[model samples]
Structure formats: structure tokens, C-alpha cells
Target: MGSYGKLVRDQIPEIITAEGREPITYIASRDEYHRRLREKLTEEVAEFLSADDAAALGELADVLEVVHALAMSLGIDSVALEELRQAKERERGGFTRRIVWTGNR
Candidate 1:
């Protein structure tokens, strides 16, 4: 049996397969996965900054996936962090408005 981390990584292929499509899900003996992630982040950041709504949404999803991987690496539960965010939003305010930065320099 593979380790928990390996199992989690392996699930990427299984998920793609379940979606009625084929995808290269294995990162074995390759750095392509990390490279693709970096490329996706770059694309998303560009789209987000350009105010492309659809692309921004896609990029946000990619960013969330990266965050999930980071959380998994740190043995942290992402769901708990999301819940904390929700709680904080309730206590304070959600990201509903844009804050304008006045020249303070």
C-alpha cells in the first residue's frame, strides 16, 4: 500500500478517469506536475490581474488546489481553515468591497 500522501496524489488520476476523461495523473520520476502547477498559477495570476472574470474564476480554483496541496504537506486540514475563514467573516466582514489604497507614502 502506498503512503497517505501517495494515495492522495494517486487520486488525481482516479478522479479524472471518473469524470469520463483520460488525463496523465502520475508525477512519478518527473517534475512536470510542479511545472504545470507553476504555469497554471502564472496564467491565473495574469488573467486575474487583467480582470477576466471567467479566467479569474478558473485561476482561483487552481490557486485553491495549490493551497490544498500546501495544507496537505503540512498535515493541516484545509476544511478547518475554510471554516475558520467563515467564522472570521461572520465576526468581521466578508470580502464584499474593494479597499482603495490612498497614497500614504
Candidate 2:
């Protein structure tokens, strides 16, 4: 037993069994899922920030997976989420301009 009390990928138990170790896991309730999803997103983001360029892509992928799960947990499909993102981007614009503001008027 690795003694992990954290959320893990769905296939993790199967993988553990294949490695000749038993993994104890249970499905999370909807409310608990929401809470854990928040934690997972923060974890993945921190990992992405701390990773080197070579490892960064993998970390980003993990972050994206967490994002997808979080969205789905909210009953938001990918298309609807993308639409919302685009709507916000169209209204407020994206970061492509690389603008910095220093104000003292």
C-alpha cells in the first residue's frame, strides 16, 4: 500500500493490480469530487510552474486533464466551455498583445 489518500486517475487501481499490489480506492461523491478537483487543479498548476521546459509539457497536459474533469463535473461540455472562453476573450481580449501598465497620472 502506497498509503496515498489523494485522488488518482481511474485506471490507477488496475495498474497497481497488474504490478502485483492491491490498491484501495473508492468513487467519490459528487460534492467530494468537486473539492478534490479543485485540489488537483492547484496541484497540477504548481507542478507546471516548477517544471523545466522538457517536463513542462507533461505537467501542462496534467493540468489540462484536470481542467477537463473540473468542467465536466460542473456539467459543462467542452464545446460550451470553449464558447464561453471565446466569448470572454472577444469581450476582454486575450494576452497576445503583451501589454504592461504603469500608471501614475
Winning model by lDDT:
2
lDDT of 2 at 60: 99
What is the Cα root-mean-square deviation between model 2 and the actual structure? 2.7
How many clashes in each structure? 0, 0
Please give, for residues 50-98, the per-residue lDDT of candidate 1 as tens digits.
Answer: 7666677866776677666545445668997688789999998787897
Over 4 Å off, model 1: 1-47, 99-105
Residues 32-102, candidate 2: write the lDDT tens digits.
Answer: 88888889888889999999999999999999899989999999988888999999999999899998879
